[model samples]
Target: MIVISDLRIAILGLGYVGLPLGLALSRHFRVFGYDSNPIRLRELRQNVDSTSETSSYTLEHSKITFLEDIKDAQDCNVFIVTVPTPIDSNNIPDLSALCAACRDIGSVLSSGDIVVFESTVYPGVTENICGPELESSSGLQCGSGFFLGYSPERINPGDRSHTVETVCKVVAGQTKGVTELLERIYGTALSAGVHVAPNIRTAEAAKVIENAQRDVNIAFINEVAMIFKNMDIDTGDVLAAARTKWNFLDFEPGLVGGHCIGVDPYYLAFGAQQAGHEPDVILAGRRINDAVASFVVDQIANMLRPSSRILVLGLTFKENVSDLRNSKVAELVTLLTQKGFQVSIHDPRAARLQAKAFYGIDLAEDLDESYSFDAVIGAVGHKEYRALDSSKLLRMVKNDGVIADLKGIWRAYDFPPPIRYWRL
Candidate 1:
């Protein structure tokens, strides 16, 4: 067994999850942070965290050595994989990034090394899929020549409270010894302690369902929002009235985007179908949530004139974060564009180049109140947009134009007679 003092930790895929975890672990162990993106490596070297999860001050003072090439981490005994587990166009769980990380780590894998995966995936992927890939590449037998562990990542981008050190970590291993090692590793990093699952697959299942449950809850609220829209009743008002009860679950209605909630349910759904369960409620929730962008666009389009010039505030999936992965705002913009609305997007947090490259939509350089649009849509609830005074918001919209609030961030502000306020 490797002691905490002797552990040489290598964190693969230093994005939102791996970077902060690496910084925390570096306090106890000699850490090597490896990422595939050269640009990311350069940015981190200069103490720039594009994800906004880590501060430049923390990055500059961290002891972990950021590496562009995997070979630099050859000496590490504990390799933690935190790569993305995205879905295909068909919504199938795509493990290409996870498998590639395995192969990369396998190339330099040594006897008695432990590879722990933090990427969210369905059950059996660690033992069935990733383990074999490591063995085929390194010619090492699982549980003997090397070991595997699971510690699902809980990093929430743009969230300041629940962090890597604050959240309770869940860990499992192929063997009791490996599990104990993970306990010591993560336990030292997280002040909130850890929950040791019985096995690796159990840990995997626990992680996948975390996001799936949130997806379903939000889907229900989104459906209710649509239902209330027909009756001309505000969903916010209904929620406020329902909250007087003790047991009301408070999930808001909005576009479910990001790498987690929008994507993880499909992994669970895929696993259920493979086990012969239809997963009716799960798939139905997905369908309702996935169609929310179109629903929002339809409502906004009906209120606007054909070929009306529109300005959309915020393009990232959620507010106050630069991460645009699987953002539904792009879908909203595309839908509006298809309906003959001339739309321009403005998100101070999102990367302009990435937005253009990913969606072919050019983000406005700056918010110019001097050039108002026929309508202004609040698609995301960024703090910057939320802090905008009513006068500034009114200035963004032309006379008799609409103020479409998708997330209800500006539901209280009553516009003048010529201008109208609309919300989902």
Candidate 2:
């Protein structure tokens, strides 16, 4: 029996999803953020987040304690897991990080404590996989001695409008009483209120499908882009014309690569496959998205001759964030290099050292240097890249240079008359 007033919240895995939630929860409850990475803990204490999702001011002002050891989180009654649920080499759901977080929480878990999982996973992950781990490790009976809950995180890395507090939250628990307790806890921070799900599996299914839906939508647009390329029609222009229809979904075509959209579908698909149902649309979407890197490479190669100098606009998975996990830009760079093109990657927010360590590619921070290229590939629609003048960017290329706009960031009418442009 725990009182709401005495709730001490511990958030595990303080990355993009956990950091913001920890900051928000710390305002009302005694919050402790735990991560296995000591470097991350040190960086957070100094008000520096490599992810760039949260500002230094917010981290500095938030009354939250940081811990690198699992033992430090023992006193917390409400544990929230927000670790990354990434995919393996074969595009399978690799639950190693999530399982490690659960195992750590289980070791320190006490009776009457409530564990809430915010990591995006397939249905039955929290109750079926994590709950048993907790019970086995802590020697406690679930629902009787300890309780479990699932509240899928809706944290978009670059999104400003739909933040942690503003977005509607879905919460579920082992039992009805546990559900009410989670609702009260989350309702304190979420201004958009909370939706109490029937069960933990339903909550997990809802979150996984959210990203899967986005993946399918983007895959549809990417396929359209490929079709438009064959027809010599601008995909963006067609989308603009189609937008006049009231019921049309305005989904743009681009490389779908990130921690969530690219990976979450696998988690759902894996579970679906285990249940003996082959997911056609979901697997098809994943296949289309996976092949987009090579498709982009082919389009770029066709636009330029061999041994041409190409500049890749951004390297991070998305714009304005430093997260490069499972980025598709690397594949584009590799394919372009293999085709005898000299590629130079530049991103304002991405960490140069991390990029070099992870991808073996050095990132150039300054684009002001006088270096002209045969083409400028707008791979990512970062705000910094979008704000640049078309004329200035055109000057970086030769008279007959090509501009490959993957995200359609530049207007076709705005490009110089002599320059050739290709957009998806």
Candidate 3:
């Protein structure tokens, strides 16, 4: 086994997960961050992170080098894979990115080297799926010529509290020595420490269940939201009263769109189906959450006046981040437009061209200067929008206009009594 102190490290696929991990690891080891996107490499070299996870100062202070070529990672003894594991159109786990990364890293795999995967996957994906790819591409024997590990990423984009170093890391390896080495290497930079699992499969299962549990919880809230809407009761008020009890988990209802929560459950459900076991609650939760986009649009149509001019605020999946992967906001806008309402979107952080290309919706550049609309929907709780004065937003709407607060960014008591307000 190679000592943790002597091993050179390379991180492949530098995005939100990989870039932050590479920056943190580079503080202690000789690190190289590789990506196939030349444009991304150039941006990182200039100390500009368009993802907004790592600032210019943080990237510059870290001793990490950005590389566009795979050869730059050849000499490293420890390689970490943090590429995205997105699902295909059929919602099946797409291993193409993982397979391609393995083939590239396997070409240069040497004895005593370890490759760790931080992408979320079903149990046994690292060993049963990725390990064989590494062996086949490198013409090496697993557990002898090369080894694998799993350390699932807990990165929450736009979250300042639970970062890479602060969050407790779960690390696992094929062998005991490999597990210990990874723990030691991660311990040097992670102040929150690490929990070493018994095996790679356990680590992968733990990661999948983490998001699945949240998906189920949010689905319950979404169902309640639909129920309360029909009953003419405020879901937020019900939650507020329920929270007076001792042990109530305060999960709010909104569009459950993002890479992790919306996509991770499918991976688990797929594995369960493959093993001849059916997942009822998991798939049911996904079904309810998936229909929420159209549900929101239906609510808006029922409330708005004829030929209403609507403004949708915050286009990103979450607040204060430009990442739009699997965003439900786009679906809501499409549904609203189909109902004959003219809709316009405004997101301070989302790129206009990117939104136009992905969703075919032109994002308004200036919110303050734009024309007033009959309805305003706060889709995402971005800080920039949160800082806006409620009076100004209320004024943007016509008399007796609706304010659909998906994230509940405004106070119900603060709004004028005449205006109709709805929150999820």
Candidate 4:
């Protein structure tokens, strides 16, 4: 019997999700945090988290041992895999990282050990795909020799309110004993408590739908935003009036891109197709959300000259963070460039190297007061962009330039007669 007292945890992938989780769990168990990137390990050792999810003070005070080599965590019996499960170029579920983590854990998996997955995936991935992979690499029976568990992670990057310790956790296991074990382990660490799922597949389904539902809701708002644009109405004003209803879901429209909401719906759609069902609504939502960048490009292009010199603000996936995975701003920039506009991008929050590496976007070092553009586009609503008042905006744009606020950040600002303002 694997007792709660004997739990030695190994956390794989120390990025956004794993870093915070490893720090929280280290308080309750002996945690060995491992990431494939040696540079990430070195940064963490010096109390630096590039993801900005965890602070330097927290890293310096944590007792968890960080490791670059997965082999160093061989003694850990409880392995929690928090690696990313992103979609490939074809929008198919890429289980490369998940499978590789399973193989790594299997090499060190001992009898009666438990392997829990916190990465978002389709319903059958934990049992149908990962189980066989673990069995093949470990040479052990899944249920009897080693156990499998699923607990979907709910960490929201750049959101400090809902964290691993504060949010309710959903967990499941292959057997009743294993389920109870996970409940005890997670229950002790999280003050928000745990919801024990009937089975592993049920837990997986719950996680995927959480983000898929958001995708559909945002798609509805995005479609509405475009319709309002054609009608010469402001989407922000319409939403402001509609929000008087107490139960109205306040979902703003913008480009949907990130690790979860932008990617998880594809996993659900793929699983539905594999089970002989066509997910029409789910797919329609994805298509609508994907086309938002193009719609934005077309709207802005119509207002400016063909040879207009434009400036784009912010490049990260969302406001106030350094995470650039699956960012829709890159697509928007590409479309603007394809339209023959001379575009220069500036993001105060995004790393210069990552901006260039991920999207071939060379971020401008600084927004010089003297240099002006024919048009200024507010793509991402970072705090720095939000603080740009009317005077600062006037200094950046030419006399007859356009200010396209895609995120409604400057909707209330009153620009001069010469500066034309547009938003969706």
Error of 3 at 388 (Å): 2.3
Write down the lDDT that model 4 would get.
Answer: 0.92
Q: How accurate locally is residue 285 in candidate 4, as Cα lDDT from 0 to 100?
A: 97
Q: Which tens-of-lDDT digit does each residue in 1-424 have in candidate 1?
A: 7777779999999998999999999988899999888998999999999898888999989999988889888889999999999999999999999999999999989999999999999998999999999999989998999999999998788889988999999999899999999998888878999999999999999999999999999999999999999999989999999988999999999999998999999999999998888998889999999999999888888888899999999989899899888999999999989999898999999998999888897899889742578899999999999998899998888878899888899887877878888887
Q: How well does candidate 4 match the true structure in TM-score terms?
A: 0.98
lDDT of 2 by residue, 1-424 (tens): 6788889999999988999899988888899999889999999999998887788998888899998788988889999999889888898888898888888988999989999999998998888888888888888888887999999999787788888989999999988888998898889987889999999999999999999999999999989889988999988879999999999998998888888999999999999998899999999999999999999898779888889999999998987778888789988899999999999999987888989987999997688773589999988889998998877888878888988888888874467657888877
Which portions of model 2 show Cα errors greater than 4 Å? none
Steric overlap count per candidate: 0, 0, 0, 0
Off by over 4 Å in 4: none
What are the clashing pairs of model 1?
none
Worst 10 residues of 1 by lDDT: 365-374
C-alpha lDDT of candidate 2 relative to the true structure: 0.89
Tens digits of per-residue lDDT, candidate 4, 284-371, equal: 9999999999999999999898989999998998999888888999999999999999999999889999998999998988998435
Q: In model 4, which range of ten residues has the least summed lDDT?
A: 363-372
